[model samples]
Target: FMTLLIGSILLPVLVLVGDIVFMFVVVSAALGAVVMTIYGGFETGIEFCHRITMAVPETYWEMIFPSSFEEKSTNWILN
Candidate 1:
């Protein structure tokens, strides 16, 4: 009879603790996935920008930003 009474009380507590642990693990996994996704996007953007800048010639930059060259803008598309 005493063991039955003890088990009844302890069983609920154990179940509640297990639920809390499960929730914590689920939330942690979700946050980790979000962070990894954002990191991946940033890495991709940086790589794309690096490629574009490296591939474009200096003349192209001067044409786009004439102020850097201390020259008047002749690009009609911008003007």
Candidate 2:
């Protein structure tokens, strides 16, 4: 009974946290779109947004794109 009561009280808090995290992700994405548009032009920005919508799972991204530091290091060596 005590466990059930605690769970009930905690459930709403957990839901609120989830909502906040979702909102943050959305806002961050919007900001990224704006920045992409400003720096890369409207077409490039739209392409970026489209890519985000079509993106594969996170694990696949990790495999497909190296970290920026790693990429920079490789480019430096090549140059």
Candidate 3:
């Protein structure tokens, strides 16, 4: 019961944090569109878009793309 309760609370937080990075990606794309519309050039639009993506916090990035070891093992037989 305790494990279930803990998992329930932590899972959503994990999901939400992961989604923030995706949200930034979408935001970056939108920024690019707006920039292109305003500046009338692909290069300037992409330059600003890259800036936003590059600005994502390092910790947030780790959450967005975890290494293989970060994930739990899935080979049931081996486990």
Candidate 4:
């Protein structure tokens, strides 16, 4: 009877401790993921902005002004 009484009290305490530890681990992982995502987004945005600014003139002429390309080529040939 005494053993049963002790077991009953200890079992709940162990279960509670396990639950608390599990919650702590899960929360820590979630926080880490959120922080990484924010930093990753900022890094990607900066990289994309740099690439766009460097490449915009070339891209604009190629895609939006094919006639200009022909004019330049003909001028070069005539020269």
Candidate 5:
């Protein structure tokens, strides 16, 4: 009974913690991108942000439904 009670409480707490951590990571990544574009003299902050946002979200999406993804210069679309 105690174990079941603990599990019920712990599961939601763990999920909340995981969500908070993911949010922190996303915010940090955005801030880092802004700083990188500012100090690194990228054409625009949004451009740097765009590149990162493009690759990262796609990678996460692919993790679940990975099919045929190619990379770099060798991509068939590039050829």
Candidate 6:
């Protein structure tokens, strides 16, 4: 029906807008945390950095660049 059509169209648009808003909120929170940690004048900055780095495992690079040698080859070709 007409309601179904409207729902299908509006649902995706709403979801996309929600995702954008959520991303902005997350970025703002991360920035605020970094600023507070840095200016708080304690070991908070170092601890935050350690926690952030520790959260990412060494295998992250493997997922990002699946083909190590091929990435360099493609970069050289493009440049």
* Residue 40, candidate 3: alpha-carbon lDDT: 73
Global CA lDDT computed for model 4:
0.58
Q: For residues 5-52, what per-residue lDDT tens digits would candidate 3 score against the true structure? A: 769997888899889988986886796669675887777677666555
RMSD, every candidate, angstroms: 22.0, 7.9, 12.3, 23.5, 6.0, 10.8
* Tens-place lDDT digits, model 1, residues 1-79: 8888778987888999999996996676556555655777867555544544443346867666665443552333311
TM for every model, in the order presented, reads: 0.45, 0.61, 0.42, 0.45, 0.60, 0.46
- In Å, residue 63's CA in model 4 sits off its true spot by 56
Model 3 — which ten-residue stretch has the worst lDDT?
Answer: 70-79
Residue runs of model 4 more than 4 Å from their true location after superposition: 42-79
Please provide the root mean square deviation of candidate 1 (C-alpha atoms, Å): 22.0
Residues 1-79, model 5: lDDT tens digits: 8888778998889999999998997998789787978787777676767666655535656645656554332222211
Residue 73, candidate 1: alpha-carbon lDDT? 28
Backbone clashes in candidate 3 total: 0
Between which residue pairs do clashes occur in model 5?
A: none
| Model 6 ranges off by over 4 Å | 42-79
CA error at residue 48 for candidate 4, angstroms = 22
Candidate 2 Cα outliers beyond 4 Å, as residue runs? 56-79
Q: In model 4, what is the error at residue 72, expressed in angstroms?
A: 65
Clashing pairs in 4: none
- What lDDT does the true structure give each of the candidates? 0.60, 0.69, 0.64, 0.58, 0.68, 0.63
Candidate 5 has a TM-score of: 0.60
Model with the higher lDDT, candidate 3 or 5:
5
The alpha-carbon lDDT assigned to residue 78 of candidate 6 equals 14
Tens-place lDDT digits, model 4, residues 1-79:
8888778987889899999996986676556555655777867555544543433344546545545654344322111
Superposed by TM-score, candidate 3 places the C-alpha of residue 63 at a distance from the truth, in angstroms, of 17
